[model samples]
Target: MALWALVSAVGLAVDDRVLVGAPIWAKPFKFFVSFAAYGLTLAWMLAQTTWGRRTGWWAGNVVVLTSLVEMVIITGQVIRGKRSHFNAETPFDASLYTVMGLTIVVLWAATLVIAALLLRTRLADRATAWAIRGGVLIALVGAGLGFLMAQPTAEQRAAGNLDTADVIGAHSVGVPDGGPAMALTGWSTTGGDLRIPHFVGMHALQLIPLFLIALVLLAPRIARLGDARVRLRLIRVATAGYAGLVALTTWQALRGQPLVHPDAPTLMAAGVLLPAVAAGVWAALRTAPEPESVRTKTEPASDSKEFTA
Candidate 1:
């Protein structure tokens, strides 16, 4: 997957062909990069799971297989200079898109199986455990968001062009695809893009665990963070905050609001989320027991001397 991403990167540089207002290779490149991270993350998850190891392992393989099928279709479409998604210009294109859709659904189901198994497994590190569990659960929801884009756009439906349309669905809500978009990512800048929420939601498995790892790395420098309970509370807070972010973004996109142009309601929602998360963190720290080092250092002199003996 990573090698494919590198190949796509080269294609991006050399191929001047533009599709949907972006380089033809851009979508394949992004998908390949995402698949590389996703595959590695699932591998790690299977290794960490104990009770349902066999089930998880098989499910992980299913995920890999389905993902490969999806990618093959995508890369193949790029080679043909045809749109991989929502393209129904020809019978072959429609069939390929349908196959891609089926493979992605299978991939999603396999991920759900792995997530269920991960939920059942026990780990000693509460923070790490929650990170994995929360990440997978949120990622499941995030992955599911892609389905929102599968429906034909209102414009297509209103035009009675559902079956005959060259494009069926669209990532953009208020605007059409291939319009003004952000650089590299190609996300719509003029209107709500469902891809924004989908991207944010789908990567929680990577982002959440990375957040936990950052906390662990900071533990030595931050005394309260060294406490297991404190760390666990913080992780819980972070997971919830991340979930809220996904929800907010999803809501924003669905309402035809571009991410960068959130209206008052969006700002108000964010305002509430920010302070709630801050308060949660503050409470976590305040309620935490003293760190091991602090407790040991504050121990009575006599006890300390006896321990030295």
Candidate 2:
């Protein structure tokens, strides 16, 4: 992952030349960074599982191999001065695009299997288990968003673009491909970009697990609050809020609203949702049972094994 990050940095530094609507090295740099993050998160999650170690091992291999294939193809295309996604300009490009699509489908399937394994296994910490399960499921939804980008939009069809038939759809909803974008991310600032929710969803695996870790570190303090169930309830509340945020962002993007320039209705929706989510969390905490520490000298040993990296 560190090596990929360094490579991404190098790609960014030398991406002054433009190709196919953006910097020639932009796609490769983004893929490198994204793959690094995904690899680290996936590895951590697999390490936490006790059951299906063999399945997890195989699944991890699949993920790594497929991810490499994706990055190689994307980077190779950029080096060739061609669009990686939605490019069917030639027989070769179309074949490469097909292979990339199929590769992602396999990756998604492997992720589902990992999610199932996580669901069936019992972890030492229920909150951590819930975090992994919820994170994978939410991440799958984010992965599925790729399908939306894979289909040609009405606008694309109307434009009679040459690559319209061979290429999948695009990332930007209200703007043409390769338009003005945000600095580092290159997500469209002038219109809705499906990549926003997609990116957020992908990182749930990392974010939710980190949240679980924070809760675990604070377990001693939390136990003093007179509620053993507080930790579990907090996890549930956070999962709900996280899922809601993903849905909200997807909705916002579908409505052609840019992430940075949300309109009145979007703001109003968020206003209502924020309080509702807070109320849910408060209710969960308020109704939790008294802390076990208040009645007992020590907590019982957990049956599950500790997660190792």
Candidate 3:
């Protein structure tokens, strides 16, 4: 779903003057992957012994809180018809601009906290552990691109602060009078294909980890579920829910019909990317392998003997 949201957002932004300089394909992919990265981080932390439960709880709290802040802005946009200043060349009220910075700061705090916890929980298998580690590394790249997305495009690249005949600092996105004439205050548009990378980074939190979870949750019973049938049924339902979400995105796209006549890409966004992902997951599942490692609860996974000769 998160990846889908990002892809649709990219599609919407593609032709817009504000994002024209952005590498469309790359940006959305970057942003979409951040979620999966985060998920893997948390999962790895859950496996680690370095952090205590309290650390996990704290990290979870911060993540939840910062996510709420992001949700607020995204929700507000949904309700109030606003564009993120970072994405648009809009003049923001100074205070709101500050809030955007604050939002990133909090999110960073969450990531750092999660990273600490992740270092504590080591996955059982070397390969799985390595994959999660790779996730963390990629996440940093996503973070950098995020900073870039908030930058100005045209005039910034030019040399000389020559007070152009353009002191008026005036110009907007398009027919709907989309973005503001001037760039948002805290943004920086440095990297050329930053958005693509950003999309890749952000969605990692959800996509990759959920992919892992689906594996762990469904494997041929590593534990004693009171009713095996019931547990399997629940797992099936959960998988369906996740897959259904992807399907839902598809439905949204079909309903929007490629956002044709109505010309409401923002509205159409609800339909596209998520379903595409859903379709991917569904297709992938047919060939999906069982989650590799399973330690019976009766024998704790972390035995001093396993670490010994």
| Stretch of 10 with least lDDT, candidate 1 | 290-299
Q: Model-by-model lDDT, in order?
A: 0.90, 0.81, 0.44
The better-scoring model by lDDT among 1 and 3 is: 1
| TM per prediction | 0.93, 0.87, 0.44
lDDT of 1 by residue, 1-309 (tens): 999999999999999999988999999999999999999998998899888788887898899899899999999999999999999999999999999899999999999999988888899898899999999999999999999898987778889947678888899998899888887788888888999889998899999999888988998998887888898998899999999999999999988888888899999999999999999999999875753554335556665567674
| Regions more than 4 Å wrong, model 2 | 160-167, 219-228, 287-309
Error of 1 at 231 (Å): 0.7
Off by over 4 Å in 3: 1-50, 87-92, 154-193, 204-309
User: How high is the lDDT of residue 122 in model 3?
Assistant: 62
- Candidate with top TM-score is 1
Model 3 lDDT tens row, 1-309: 365556546654653422323322323333335444554456555555454767767766676566556545543443333443443324343344447557777767666666655655665554244335444544544564466434443453354343332121111111111222213221122212333335446444445445555555655554323233333333343344443433333332223222122235534554564565566545444443445578757756686887687
| Comparing 1 and 2 on lDDT, the stronger one | 1
lDDT of 2 by residue, 204-260 (tens): 888888887787787677753234367677778888888888888999888877899
Quote the RMSD, in angstroms, for model 1: 4.9
Kindly provide the TM-score of model 1 when superposed on the true structure, using C-alpha atoms.
0.93
TM-score of 2: 0.87
Top lDDT: which candidate number? 1
